[model samples]
Target: DIKPIEQLNINNLINKRNFRGIFGTQPPLSILEEIDYIIVSPGVPFDIPIILKAIEENIEVISEIELSYRLSNGKIIAITGTNGKTTTTSMVGEIFKESRKDSYAVGNIGLPMISKIDYSTNETSFIVEVSSFQLEGIKEFHPHISAVLNITPDHLNRHKTMENYIDQKSRVFLNQTPNDITILNKDNPITFSFKDKTPGKVILFSRLSTLEKGVFIEDNQIIIRNEEKERLLVCPVSDIKILGGHNLENALAAVAISYYAGIPIQSIRKALKKFKGVAHRIERVDIISGVEFINDSKGTNPESSIKAIEAMEKPIILIAGGMDKGSDLSEFVLSFKNKVRYLILLGETANIIENLARGQGINNIKKVASMEEAVLFSFNIANKGDVVLLSPGCASWDMYSSYEERGNIFKSLVKDLRR
Candidate 1:
């Protein structure tokens, strides 16, 4: 131990493990002699002093995901995007479960990939939901199958530019060979541009149109065609229980990924029909006074929130705004033109979104300081059949530690309304 502490827990744990523990923000350079490679978590920025020092010292600095990838031995399917990554990853995991594969759904939405490495085997399947931050430090980390669901303007505050952000997301398929397969969103121009980027067999999924070879919706049914132009129908659009066209894309992605992995068509259909959805992304909470409450806290970006706004069938009493990530929310505001009845905003970007909404000639906006207030105001103004949606078009860092935390709090508040 290098620093004195009042608590014995951390010190005792360090002593019990018989390892050195440095408790300060900055460590002395003398300690560097024993340190070989520096492991960075996805949350840790590379520009920090210690990480920069490690880089300068020619030490191998890598993200925990990269380390996990190096140690993980399984048929890995890595999914990354600005949105729908969680849903898509979870869907793929469900498909694997139906097929009875010894699989683990780990990464951003579940356990850390590193934690599951010890449990992973040659026969195991790891459905990893990777983020741009996790992709930052990957060296030889490659997945057997990789999918970039869609690329949108997100995390610009960290990457500084759209190009750099895409660059990191692109890393998911960087080390794949021709033997591997990569699923790209054919409808997404940015992800579609990756058609020429990978050596892996490009499997495209589309909701708008049919593709020559890949997964697509045809005659309102999910279909896949191989290189030989042979078509296979998985299931009908009505079979999927998840809401939204965006979720339909996610379902198509899951099919593309699992079908390529050799899952039976029946198993794929079974999973698709049975798969509900992940929490915090357009999740139905409870209804009070005939008003529907939806938690779409996973809509951490404007593009994502736009989809959530579009997904609703009822007149929306939209609750949005969170930590500003310097995104163009004009489209976000514009999407609420005829759909959203009233807006209750909160968090850092509340004023910014409010001004944008007003500039667009919409004045039915209420600004609140907390989620409880946002929910109450929405409920107060909401009538029978109006949807109160908490689809924040920004990150949760302004108020909560994570989107899950923000969504949980909103759910708690909504459920409390019944009390």
Candidate 2:
């Protein structure tokens, strides 16, 4: 009297460690009726029929993040946004380390948070880079300090609507109380509008505006004003190694979060000056034939790719396109038209991007089926002072294991070219 699992085979059940016995087809009515909990993977859509069925059956559904949160005793400082999450999370972890605290940065930055869980101590802190998919299925996944850096139009294909996407991102603060801190990007209109959404104490970080309680840049100094004390922590912005106005905002967010987590001002300053950045996010590879090659494979959204393009001082041979996540590439058209001297489109979104470029009257666009072809094409067209940048404004899942793998390939190809 067992029902079978639908759309899944024996291997799937075995891989999932479902030892209750999986039938070839839908399980028997008796087995289906007794089901209690359903764990959904990030790859499984929330709107899936099986999830709806589970809900109808009064079964509890949860994500891996929820499970991790339940088991973790460490102070969690979770980061989420369409972009810059990894860099900010890494920077915050560095700040904690500089303060001589036991801290580890993990999670969606490709290292699982569960893998870093130390059973030995209760003093360790975790800085996790979370995603919307991970946030979507949570039940009680609350972090001690949560920061939504910024949210743009992204992952629409999975969420099916922008509102749903924003709702998912807001889950980062779902279970927090007033004692917890919620840091937000005040400059991001979308994140700013969510000010009334969370019940936790709000701390705002901005690059364009001043905040009474959070961090901001004013008169060339990075300022952290204490709303409770009316005191200030100030440092020069030039001390930060990461470039771009966007990164300035990221640094501000990290500083606010780490400062609240008990990291001293001097430790924060030391981390800011010494921390370079996370890999594959505007990562400079090498100068081949005098053309600088940057592997920014983590810029999977148009907003992030635009930031990478904006950070470029030299003329760029922009490598873009991948599995389209239903993001609007039109947002980057002006940046590409101005900064990019050549466009090398790759992966599933190539034709769509190429058409968009052509529609915009851009003629220097070229399509290549693989990264090697794209690199060679870029190298052929790149001048001595120009840069060949792999800042694909789409996901790398279509062609490689992960964004890191895609970035490594670009680095390897660029190194081979140098040799």
Instruction: Please report the candidate that would top lDDT against the real structure.
Output: 1
Q: Residues 1-419, candidate 2, lDDT per residue (tens digit)? A: 12345434356646788477545544444554767786666776767566777777878888877777778877888899988898998898888888889888888877777777655157988888999999987888879899999999998999989999999999999999999999989999989877899878999989997776788888888988886756575578898778688888889989999888988899999989998988998898898778999999998888999999999999999999998888888877667877889988989899888888888888998888899999888888888999998999999988986788899999999988866
Q: After superposition, how far is residue 352 of candidate 2 from its true place, in Å?
A: 1.4
Candidate 1's C-alpha lDDT? 0.90
Model 1 C-alpha lDDT per residue in residues 167-218, reported as the tens digit of each score: 9999999999999998999999999999899889899999999899999999
Which segments of model 1 are wrong by more than 4 Å? 1-31
Q: What is the lDDT of candidate 2?
A: 0.85
Clashes per candidate, residues 3 or more apart or on different chains: 0, 8
Off by over 4 Å in 2: 1-36, 118-120, 229-231
The number of the candidate with the highest TM-score is 1
